[model samples]
Target: MTVDPEYASALADGLTIPHYVWGKQVDPLGEIDNITYILLAKDQEEMRLRLLGSATQTMSIILVIVIFVSSTLSTAWRVFRQPRSVVNWCTFVQSSSATMAFGFGITMKLSTACNCRWAIWTASLGQAISGICASIVLVWKAYLAYDRDRRFVWAGIILNLPEPLYLYAAWMHSRTTFTPLGGCTMLYPSWLPWARFGMDGPFNVIFSAAFIVVAARQYRKHGSAVWGSLRNEGTIGLLILTFSNIFCLLLTATNFADEYSMMFWGVDWLITNQILIHQHRPMRRSLHESGRARGRNRNARRHDAETLFHPQPMSPSDKFAQWAELNLLQPKSNSPLASVLEAPEPDISDIGHTPAPNTASHLHSTQASTGYW
Candidate 1:
């Protein structure tokens, strides 16, 4: 087999990706940037062992953080007011999967930099777990959007029901199908990796199309007749969210298809983060509004209670209050007709006679004295 020194050197020179080592599973002195170097498995198993130990440490740290975040979010949902029902659950799945992805990255996928057979096994486990969660969330999100809108045409209620089940089966396959392909991966049994890629595409198409279709229909049906801008904004946000997720999840299929030998999980990272924390902006806005609301609520009640109980004269030093009142309240006009019009017109029958239009001005003069204006 060809040595990887040129590749490692090229990469190191191009980007600053950190490196670690596992067992003899990876080429160490591969081309870091553009220059070739030694350090293949034949060079030194001792160095490989050291890299493995360090990688294991890194994986452990990431795994711990993932567990903490997942548990904390779960507990928060159970005890406190959940941010949302479906969206929150989807988020939990995404977060857990992400943690697992990171664990896998540090373990088997990046094994060249940090190789260990045990770490490889652990990484595989983490990746499988993440995949299973992703499958479930995908199915859930699709159904949630469709059912909420009550949109479908002859599609079965459990149309995408096979998603989670297929994912579980795929995870099982990964266990039985692993190989020593210089690292831990389900690329063994050859059929398994392709199978995974196969499942992801159909799964993504079903759910993504479902959501996109439903959202479009909803916008078309309601957007036209409804003059409410809030509806439009909400519908538009849903579209943005749906399309972004579709593009993100679609990568799983791409990975399976081997479009790129190198997997970039960053898109997946940002996608799940955006999805789960969909309400992040809304939550932030609510917090800001709540502060103002609390103050307003307190002021409103105080104003009411004070008027009913204290009935004190306005303080002259309260310039703000005075200025606010002046700005908020319209001032009365200093003209006679303006004052007269401000008063309620007397009932024509109360006079018991019809008045001449010429005397209308004289009748108005009496009303201003009562200060109804």
Candidate 2:
């Protein structure tokens, strides 16, 4: 009657929980030199939850990659459109956030003893760098917005500092944990699988809170609309930042990393555009203004009609008809977006559809009909 070492060890350790136990091959020298393998039993109940978490993590990674590439390109594209402003800097901040949440978040997220120590170092450093970048750029957006509102700018103070310190601090912390493919994180020395819990967890909580607070405080007057810029652009940054922080908190709290890793990936992927695109206002506006300037207006605007019909101008009727079209189609200056709205389709009786009386017929008839052409 031989005692099994696996059960015997667990019993000796006073352990009762179930776990995955790996058994080994036993040789013929059973009595004197037996080389039997053993494994610790795993809890069956945790199987499904942990599996789901793993799937979620996979998806989260895919999304992060998408975000990284897309964001990089988006900023690049903006470079061509708005060469004057450092818009890419602001856009890159959003990109960095998406990268950190799924990239480093997952690494610290999977900080098990089995994970290589080197990975923890790199991921942690990467996140720290990303965070530093994000914070600076976020602050930059506020600065730019305020600059736009108030013409004065403090160029000297703004340009000479901050990033160097950010880069140096991130590098120093990262040296503690950097290994292949694995991201960096603090080395925790705890049994419950949350050794670096104190170091990493607290920062996320604090930063998230600060991000939301700053965004809220700065935009209090504008409510994300920023008055001059598009409404969507004003609030998109805050929304993305808020969502990232909230997800980070949730992941930490529920051990989702331990259970639904893939779900996190999905979230990371979605955020890339949400966060960065807010900075694409210049692009969006450029398109709108150009379209307006170019004759996209359905009225068939004769913007260059004066030049076209130079010396011998056409009859006043021809001019009136053309002008009528422009006046009718000219986008409302007060609201550039008013055209997108569906105007109450002109009822036959309500007027716009009524044919314009020929100018020669009667001035009163033309005026009374509210004619365009």
Candidate 3:
């Protein structure tokens, strides 16, 4: 075996060199075969990792694309078929952000056409957008559930604001590099996991807790009716999201790879936006309708019960006039009979009058004496 002078010098100095590069050392005997095998094995492993990453990314992208198409079509259909309403614009933003994040990521991973910087930056921006928009939608839901109380809304906004800010700062310091097998690898600081955790963990806990509390209150107030209202709002979806967030937070807290933890990222975005887009409208409408129904019932109760019942038998004048018309007189204008019939009855309630017990008899006696009846 013949060793190159530089290789001998590097080995003597205890400097480490890549096996592939070190393989270039002159070896007239068959000693280079071992280095070649090592390099080949390393290449194989790299290729396998690249292939696995590509396959997973492709699957995530396909899932997100399907969800995006369906959600877009559904939202469009709703926009056209329904009247203008309190539709949350965040729903649209959520869908777009998820699609963009996954789409850009998959595109950058699969193809080498675009600059990596652009692709990675766009994907990062999309992720930030999705997270922020999702937070907004959650706070809005809590707002609606709590009777549109601005105090909680403001508190939620304040609490959630830090996640995106920290995310932005972390992303600024983050870096990525292309692997030997044509895959991108995220290079981040040790605190990257904490950043990811902060992006979703605590705020999700608060929002999900708020929702669950509201649901409990509704169940208490309305019993089974809460099911009817929450069916439209997808209470189960909220639980799913809460659990998913908790799972993601655990993954991050345990120092799992960001890439592995992100498998559900796009799917989470889809569900978040889908809940807001389809379920929220019905929930809001149900709340508004229920409110209006209560108002109507309250107003209905204020009406005088006597007015709702049939008027007291009939006034003596009305009975007598009817009998006279049937038996003798045809109603004629400018006649005394016509004047009697046309005269407006004084409203007892307005005049503060209480009729006597013999009021009907007394009225009949007076009319008979006056020859009016």
Candidate 4:
């Protein structure tokens, strides 16, 4: 029952050790309880490794495909329904590329026909396109937020040019072999397994950093109130892109398994797309409302100015009075006869002359006689 040390070591290292019986090469692991047959520790470990690798790959493939498909559909729907902006178009491109890449990846994982030479080529191409689109999206947003120059955008495109070439080269150079547990397992180059990350990582990080700086500057210059309204629309998408790229880079740097790393990347992209879609709606609504408010304010100011300069028309009675005054048809009465008929007014000359000495004596005698009794 003792296993050979060399066989144990090879098995531990995930190597398939050949079974031998009676000094002849034999499939002893296939036989049961035969005295001439023997199973070594390496065989058991190899089996376990294959099983684990297969399970991991299957799970990863499923997860990536589901996430990519759902995200792609959602993004496509948004792009179709909503007005297209630079950001929207970028999102659409990223989503579409991701969908194709992951879809092809799933086919490769599931189909035996994927062993053909063209499979890897197509897979590499799809992934490269997806990555370039994503990088462009991030850079585009940054440029729009800060630089907004066509030259800068073109420069970004130029910078991303090498990614696809590198991806194809890396994929072509990668080691692909058939395994019993997994149909075809591709072992990429140790130095550059993911060409997308290798080529676009620096650019993605730099542009993301630039976006953060530009967003911060905008927030400071415009104040929190103004920036707060724009946070979801402008800053959040950049933040998501930055963090997702950082996560992918960290996973790659730490030498995490490629299956898990790729799955994580897909999930991150799906979440980013969802966030962008969610943020887009509110941004559009806010913009629409602001435009309406501005229009209403303009109309109100115009109405106020018009009312201030031009008086309102008079009512019917007021118009009649105005017309009468203009035609000199109004009544005027200040004649003495009219005043005497209304109420007589005593004259100052009469008051001074009427009270003569005779009048005064006769008035006094009459008053005394009337009151005598």
Candidate 5:
């Protein structure tokens, strides 16, 4: 007589059992023994959970791809319409790298779905590359916001120069194995996973924190005007990156890589969208100044018109002269001058006053004087 390995394994684990002889109750020493039905049910339930988790990861990857595509198009359109700047070029690089990262992540997820041996290798390599790109973005933003020393930027760049070699090492050391749930999963030496996480995770946290602190300090020192050039979208995106990294660290520490791999894609999506939106919108102060100038011009025009058409009461001499002309300067109806004298004297009380300066020109001068433009 033979027993299923699964049944034997279950029994070895001390799961409850029943003894019987041809459907009749028997002593504890009965030759027929079986694992409880509850054990089989539990195994089925575990499989269901795994399937649900996979489905969730797939949906998340799809959504991330959609967001990446839309944001890339938006950024490209904005770049085409607007004059380029250093910041714009940096934004383009960051967005391009993020899009590549998302693409690789999608590929890794698809490979995993197919239960390919390469899935783990691809996932490891893709995530490493993506992490490197994300780090570059954060470092660049930090340089823009706080670091004055160009050497620091160069140093940071040099630090990441070996990422390709590191990734190659990770791939070379990884091995493929069969797994009941994921199938053909790639397994890294225990030290390798921790080493990768150790290098990437702490740096991610530190960089994110540094970015927030630097931005906040700048905001406090210069007020919101500093952000006029930086854009709120970049600040908000940094915040999102910070929190997402914290979450990713937590998930990785808890050994939930498969359950939360989608977070990597999400971070890239956030970065791409932030760059796109920030580039599309103009600076806030410029918009405000333009509106204010228009308002001032309108008010000036109104005041000038009132002064012209509704001059203050005429002086007594002016009034007397006007009355004398109307009553004493009578002329024969046939005279050519009669038409000129008979016509009501044109009101010229305000004509002597200088014409109001051009309101638009005045406002423009004021803007220049105040540096509002």
Candidate 6:
């Protein structure tokens, strides 16, 4: 852990880091001038931030990739089998955004004085593209939810029209520095954090509001039975996106450019993509038909229906496989496995037969029906 005198001197003279500090200790501050000691301390802090940022960003990237891969694989066959232009384009943009984020993160982590400018420009362009694409995807979902309402769609389009130019302007005013730790850091104007909030906050609000309105309409049409429909519709994923966006906004506003900041980058796109995949899963769409029927029978109290239907609820893994069957298997009509692989339709014959009192079986039945949202 011996410190190198020449390296230390060069660092104190404000030169770029020549090498990484691998378990090497800083020389005693007693032998250095006050200015050198201060510089060393500052560099130590910057190095800590750099290493932490790299680690967290790596984890974020890994998680995003896993989500993308699993979601894409699950939907790949279906996407091809039933080609919808909206979903197709959405998948493309999600892939593009994830790629840009991956590249931008790698460049930031591996940046040096030699590539500092490259990192800066990459960051500016890559991040702008990623963010704007994510926003567009979100707005498109809202537009579809609103039944392609012109006003809502046009508002979203116009609001986001300035995103590229705004980002370009912000990057122009931003300052970049090469850290003594051999990483690049960008210092943006205070308005940048709020700019991010402004860019994303409205879309999230609009999308969430539109989703809730749709849910409410379903509820009015189906009553308490709408739970199953909601579950099958990826309500949980929607809520996750809503809360995560709010949390990230809070962090960016209060602690801008801190360790927590970069970790959330591209998360919205990842989660949104997952939701889209989940919604389009074949099992979910089939479930939705029964979901409405279940809602329709909500008023006729069938307290023991759940107990009779699901004496023992399926386990999580079993439930997942059941849900995943459509993605994994397409039973050949002539094969023996066809009968085995095919799921039995739920017998809603007894759904409203008896006007029994409400009971916990209702809750159990609800959980058993959808498993989890």
What CA root-mean-square deviation does each model show from the true structure? Answer: 13.1, 18.3, 15.0, 17.1, 21.2, 21.9
Overall lDDT per candidate, in order of appearance: 0.44, 0.42, 0.57, 0.55, 0.51, 0.54
Model 3 spans with C-alpha error above 4 angstroms: 1-49, 79-87, 109-111, 180-182, 222-235, 253-264, 274-278, 292-373
TM-score of 1: 0.43
- Our tally of clashes for model 6 stands at 1
TM-score of each: 0.43, 0.38, 0.57, 0.53, 0.46, 0.53
Identify the candidate with maximal TM-score: 3
Residues 1-373 of candidate 2 have per-residue lDDT tens digits of: 4544534433443434332223322211111100010111145444444344444444556656666767767776766655544546555655655555455444433533222222333444444445445444444444443333221124323432443443343334222222112222222222212322233234433433443444455445444433334334445555565556556545644555442332342353355345545544543343243222322342334545655667566899999988987766565555645656545565567556767767766876676688755
lDDT of 5 by residue, 1-373 (tens): 3443434533544543344323433222111111111223347776565455445655765776677677667656656754333344445555555556546545544542222323444555655655565556556555544534465477567666656764665456543432234322444444544455455555655655565565456556556564444445445655665555566555544557653532543464365346435533543243243222322455568889999999989999999998888766765677778877678987888887968899999999999999988
lDDT of 5 at 201: 52
lDDT of 1: 0.44
After superposition, the stretches of candidate 2 with alpha carbons farther than 4 Å from their true spots are 1-59, 93-120, 148-233, 236-240, 253-273, 282-373
Per-residue lDDT of candidate 3, residues 146-251 (tens digit): 7767987788678766666655543565544333332344444666656665667677667756866766666566664744566535657667766666665566
Candidate 1, residues 1-373, lDDT tens digits: the string is: 4444524532443433334332232323221211111122223664465346434444544655565366437634633454444445555665665555555445433334433333434444544445444455545545555543333322333444444554444334322111112123233234443454454445545654555454456446555322223234434544554455455445544554342211323443344354435423243232232222322455568889999998877786786778877754544577665577688877777575765676666567766766665
Report the C-alpha displacement of residue 282, candidate 6, in angstroms: 7.4
Worst 10 residues of 2 by lDDT: 30-39
TM-score of 5: 0.46
lDDT of 4 by residue, 262-353 (tens): 34545555665565555545443433433223224555678899999987888999998898985545434576554555675656776656
Q: Tell me which of candidates 4 and 6 scores higher on TM-score.
A: 4
* Better candidate number, 1 or 6, judged by TM-score: 6
Q: Which candidate is the best by lDDT?
A: 3
Instruction: Identify the runs in model 4 with alpha carbons over 4 angstroms from their true place.
Output: 1-52, 109-113, 116-119, 179-183, 193-198, 224-226, 229-373
